[model samples]
Target chain A: MIKLEIKLMKNILGANDEIAALNRKLFAERGVVVMNLMGSPGSGKTTLLEKTLVRLVDKIKIAVIEGDLFTAKDAERIERAGVEVIQINTAGGCHLDAAMIQKACTSLDLNAIDLLIVENVGNLVCPAEFDIGENFKAVVLSITEGDDKPLKYPLIFKESEVTLLNKIDLLPFTNFDLRSAREDLITLHPTIKIFETSCTGGTGLEDWCTWLLQKVAR
Target chain B: MHEATLAENILNIALEAAKQNQAAKIFKIGLTLGEMAGVEVEALTLSFDVLKKNTPADGAELAIKRVPISAVCNKCGKIFQLESYNFFCPACDGILILQSGRELLVDFVDCE
Candidate 1:
């Protein structure tokens, strides 16, 4: 004898989204602007973040929640920049979901914090699928990466509110086709803002900073 | 790499449901995997096989339903499934933003 149950097949994402919504409400009430920074492992996410922290340390209180496979080095770098930082080692996990973020938030002082930057584990695929209760998703695509990245991984490009084309200083050296990259991304996401910057050279960084400040104001 | 974790989640959900319904054995479990879920079905199946050995769901059959890639046209506000990698709307050359292809769900269970 066997019984068949016809469940509605609710979205498995429901759990993660519910936690994300809660985090959003908490952020709104506390006037905190949370940014979900996503990119590949070597896309210069931490380097760009370090630059941002250097510029905004005097104006606004910032905190960082670093997600990694197995290291506290990034958290240490952020801590040395004179701000509160928490490191989440996913162990073998590919992405950081809202529940993990909620646990990390318990250690930070949300009252005094104006911005909370959650650096997701460096992976384009899984991170984009998980909602970590962020106001917006910011992606970093270094020029060193292939120009076909946007076409290969369309989800990250489509889901991102802002895309940072990092490592512009190396553009001259690499055979990266900028025109095709922009065209491919525009085909997927027309409204997404694209920024060209190099954390190493400090080129085209003001735009990213301005964008960050604007989001914090809202 | 994350197959072990995903398998654990699946087993947890199945066991909880089985306990609620007083099921002596689980017959089958249904899963919906989206196109862009970033999870490998083969790896998941392999993980389930190894992890379910001697467990409550030891003999349970796993059935997978794949979700197709879909997008919504920004200009026309129309949703359609993509048969290929092209992201442009066929009716119009408007950019199509992704609306699906990232689902991961455990839809139903068979118990006795």
Candidate 2:
């Protein structure tokens, strides 16, 4: 039997990157700033989105793409916040790929929106690997999850442009160390922007909203 | 799992390369996965086994190479391999800048 060798040094994620590039082009053409929000389950991703929506819905036109394994519950919550919402049920898929975002983009009124927030399926691991064509990735880590999370899951922290230390209101009750988390984040990513937020008490919503608005404007 | 999806992508890449080269069937596929790529090797192998049925790469052997994380020291300008998760430079104990770790690529494929 004759054998032939094909030396192809192609990236396995090349397909996803191609589609992500297309999505990025579409976002740029439509003048939309997309943010991919990722975190673990019960990391207050949805609540933070809800708070952001409540604050900026009147000032800026916004849309949301909520990703989950099952149910339209998060989408419903975002809908209640009075924003155009689309829910993608991955049906056991751990992360959202660029193709999903490409399909989702066709359904949104991109011309009427300034920002599109895609809440990734509450997974810190898989979601960080796939780029869904967002301007930048923002990772949410609750204070109750402990500060060692950054070292344990370095890929997510390294890939994210911003880190939201959520549930700060529970910090007094938990054994989480804020200083260690900050130092770890700084080590992993020297220039990562960090925000401390408490959705229930609304501690840093204004700063978060202002920072996001500046991003959308750009 | 994401491994299944990743396996599918790898199969697609192999098939596409085989077609471009006018090869009959793929015999071996080589992949490079970084230590910090967050992918489970056994799970990816299992997923490849299940998804390669009836395709050009049906019985192809997969060889995966794991690359350890490496970093360059920003302060001392020393490059070092990171055996552990600590990002400190071995020479000067400075915070090392990550050089390689997040790579997932199909290096080569053998076909007939």
Candidate 3:
């Protein structure tokens, strides 16, 4: 047998990165700010998006791509909020790939939107690994998930530019320690912005909306 | 869960490399996975085993090398290997800036 060694040195994420780069270029040309929202199931990602839509729909032209495993439940809810929404049912796939985002973009009129929010599949681990061509990643961590989440899933916390601590209204009911969670998040990501929010109570939604508006403006 | 997709990517890369080198068959593929990459080695190996069949890299051995998370201290500029999840610098106890441990690369391929 003959021997031949080829030093490829190719990145595993190279394929995804290329597609993501293309999506980023397209978004830039359309002058749209895309945000990839990631988190665990039941982390209130959908609720937070609804709350954001309620506040920003009047000021900014927003569109959403809701990713789920099987049902169009989240997409339907977003439709009620009255913004242009598209649903991507991964079927059995755990994460949304760049190719999927590219296909989804074909259906959207990007030129009409100011902000495009891709609500990634409700998985903290896999979604963080794949970049779907967003300006930045924002993770929603409900207080009920416990403060140890930052340490347990450091990659998601580390990869995210902002962390929204949702369900703050349930803090008194649960044993979640906000201070310890903040400290842990700081250790994992030195400068990550943290937002405490309760979608139902309207707590911290104003600040979150203000920050999002500023990001879109920039 | 995503290991299967990752394995497919690895196979694609191997096939492309083998074709570029004008090789008939691939023998081995070397991969570098960072400790914090969130990919399980066993799952990825299993995925490769199942997906490699009927491809140019069929029966090829996959060798994965795991790299520990390393960081540089921002305050004192000290480089250190992190043993645990805590990212504090050992020398200065300052905020540690991650230097490595997020890599997933197809390092090389052996073919003939």
The candidate maximizing TM-score is 3
Query: Which of the two candidates, 1 or 3, achieves a greater TM-score against the reference?
Result: 3
CAPRI verdict on model 2?
A: medium
User: Which candidate number maximizes DockQ?
Assistant: 3
lDDT of 1 by residue, B37-87 (tens): 767888889988898888779998888999898999888888989876567
Q: Give each prediction's root-mean-square deviation over alpha carbons.
A: 2.1, 2.2, 1.6
Per-residue CA lDDT of candidate 1, range A1-218, in tens?
A: 56757463755566678999999999888889999999999999999999999999998899999999898999998898998999999987888989999999988889999999999999987788778888899999999998999988887887899999999999889999999988888766777899999997898888889889988886
The CAPRI-style docking tier of model 1 reads medium
Error of 1 at B109 (Å): 0.7
lDDT (0-100) at residue B78 of candidate 2? 87
10 residues in a row with least lDDT, candidate 1 chain B: B1-10
True contacts kept of each: 0.54, 0.83, 0.86
Which pairs clash (backbone N, Cα, C closer than 3 Å) in model 3? Answer: none
Per-candidate DockQ versus the true complex? 0.51, 0.66, 0.77
- Choose the strongest candidate by lDDT: 3
Candidate 3, residues A69-167: lDDT per residue as tens digits? 999999999999999999999999999999999999999999999999999999878999998889999999999899999999999999999999999
lDDT, candidate 1, residue B49?
86
Error of 1 at A19 (Å): 2.2
lDDT of 3 at A214: 97
Local distance difference test, per candidate? Answer: 0.86, 0.91, 0.93
Q: Estimate each model's TM-score.
A: 0.92, 0.92, 0.95
